[model samples]
Target chain A: MKMSFEHRDGLGLLRVEEPRIDASVAIQFKDRFHDLTQNGTGDVILDLSQVDFLDSSGLGALVGARKLLGAGRVLELCGLTPTVDRVMVLTRMHTVFPIHPDLVTALATRAATS
Target chain B: MTGPGPIPGVIGPRPWGLTLRFAATPVAVRAALSAVDAGLADAGAPDDLRARAQIALAEACNNIVEHAYPRHPPPTEAHIRLDIAADLGGLQITLRDRGRAMPDGPLPGRELPPLDPGDIAGLPEGGFGWAILRDMTRAISLSRRNGQNILRFRLPHADKPGPLSRIVT
Candidate 1:
């Protein structure tokens, strides 16, 4: 699970650098995502522009990461690749997390609120 | 896929068909899928079939790894055979395993998760795999034959992918 993280004050962003998120990296993705965003405040946008494919395990990991974040912090998603975005919508995961078309929109939502 | 070639392991050669076996481990998932994609590429399989098969087969193979050898009894091996038809009209994949059968004897006919938008508690975390297999592939069948769990499916599509809703699948 190749990834890079950027944090400023309480706002944080995690960009996943992988083409496919399947069973092989599902668990790793969840653990690393949670560990990276565990200390953040406000909103954390997960960028998945590079992910072309995602499976059930990856979905589960995302959902689990959301749950692990508890209720205070927001684990929003942004920049979902078309293929990855489709799976998220198909599973109604878009219902669970606020999905933005890109990072700018995700940050804009945060700005509008705060 | 010139004329069925010869049956696997028979008299002559089987140039168009390929079979592979893997240990029932998560690592085998990538290896098996990459090999199948390469094989399909060699046979000129369309992107649609190649795309769907990638997901469906992942679910199938992962199912084998997760369910075949639960936790107590240890794991076994899984087999995959990719066969292109005589005229190259379509492709067939047969996945074989020596492990346990599906809990319900066959995969359940599950639909996409219900449309519940607001309620986090009502949101689903899993159970989308089999639905993906059913929606992506044209035909799918699972059975137990001679103490071997056999799952064979077909990808007969020749066009581009469908709309975003199908992508959700």
Candidate 2:
């Protein structure tokens, strides 16, 4: 899986272009997190529009990303499809991260607050 | 008079056309579910039924991968089978593995505890697979035979009247 990162106005938008994030790709998902956090830009917004499936391992990786962001840094998620959204809802992780409907809304909100 | 009787879980007089094999890794579990999904579709199951079946099967396969294979190196095999019935009502699935036997009591029920915002904020990282399977299917049975753990889940005929309906009508 490949993750593309774009930075605008101090918000890091990470887009994941993968169809499934189950056990088969959990390792790559973890590795991508490592690379994303290496730059120490903690204000992150993940765009999951392309991901259609996610299991526990995939959920764990997102939590791990939150931990890596440290205190006062925010990690939000955007563009969750219904299937992926259901997993987050079932696991109750939806509350842990702020979820936005789209990248434009996330960016716009961040801009308004900043 | 004819050879041995048909296998216990297998239906029909064709002498058990089903075949079961052990998939030794998590990768294999995913492959097994995909194969089963395709097979179910090819066998003329309706789209809604196939979707539910696929979701349930994926959850079960993930459980085996997470719980059964935890800490075990790759190649920890789980048994998988392809069961087909000429009569749609008798369709069944049998999944078995040599991992630690699941608790000998009844598995958890299907009702999901309501999700509170605070609880969601503190939600633990794992332990969601069983609930997913439970919610997606009507019945699940677990047993241990000869040191191998077996899990069987069945879906009733889509058009059949359920228990409550039968009682009312």
Candidate 3:
């Protein structure tokens, strides 16, 4: 359930420092996301490189975090592992978020645009 | 959401099979899924197959923990039992629990929650479990009897073609 947050280049970078985000930690993950990004105005990018597994509850938490960020601000995702990517595709959630291949690309793209 | 009867004959003792029981709790279900994933890897399951197995199994077991075993009153001794058997065809999974029957005495329909991009507030966070289960496994069935719920499904091996797709490429 550990997560690290950084506000850089007017973007909120939240990295989940855990291997799996399942039912056991979904609630904590959403709460932490809210706590970290509640005051930020810019878009938030979630890094899922370290997370190998994400169940439906975890997916729900991700959606919840996005709602917490509000409608105007987008909650982007990056570095989804194979399984996580599969889940996103199967659920058609990949269409909902702007996904980047990695953190560097996400940051660089955002920085270049802004 | 299709079949609702006794688990198929395929779910029985096999030399390569394993059985385990754990309390019907999120933490324990997580541990059980992790153990099963490792076991699949150890049994030489391909990455794609293993991933699908883990994902589908997680949704099913979590449903039991979330729905079958209500947390309000919290049954005295609720537990989930898993029977996993691996073969050249694929893996067979039978999940059993004695807590509560499904709401309507049948499996829930396999409809994915709508993801209306425009309606951010109306987007669904849950109800994706059944759709995920439907996508990952085959011959999935559910049955409730004697105050027990039995769920069965088969995960195909990566290299093995399914019954309908057995033609050689």
Best by TM-score: 3
Off by over 4 Å in 3: B1-15, B159-169
Task: State the weakest 10-residue window (summed lDDT) of model 1 chain B.
Answer: B3-12
Tell me model 3's lDDT, rounded to 2 decimals: 0.82
lDDT of 1 by residue, B100-149 (tens): 77777545654766656455445567788876666556567878888788
Ranking by TM-score: 3, 1, 2
lDDT of 3 by residue, B80-99 (tens): 99998776567789999997
- Residue B142, candidate 3: C-alpha displacement in angstroms: 1.0
Tell me the alpha-carbon RMSD of every candidate.
5.4, 7.5, 7.0
Q: Which of the two candidates, 1 or 2, achieves a greater TM-score against the reference?
A: 1
**Candidate 2 residue-wise lDDT, A1-114, digit = tens:** 788987776767789988767777777887887787668664889999998767666776676666667656788899998767866765556767889999999888887887
Error of 3 at A64 (Å): 0.4
Candidate 1 stretches with Cα past 4 Å from truth are A112-114, B1-17, B72-89, B104-106, B113-115, B158-169
- TM-score chain B for all models: 0.73, 0.69, 0.80
What TM-score would chain B of candidate 1 score versus the native chain B?
Answer: 0.73
* Per-residue lDDT of candidate 3, residues A1-114 (tens digit): 799999987889999999999998999999999999999999889999999999999999999988888898999999999889978877778878999999999888887887
Classify candidate 1 by CAPRI docking class: acceptable
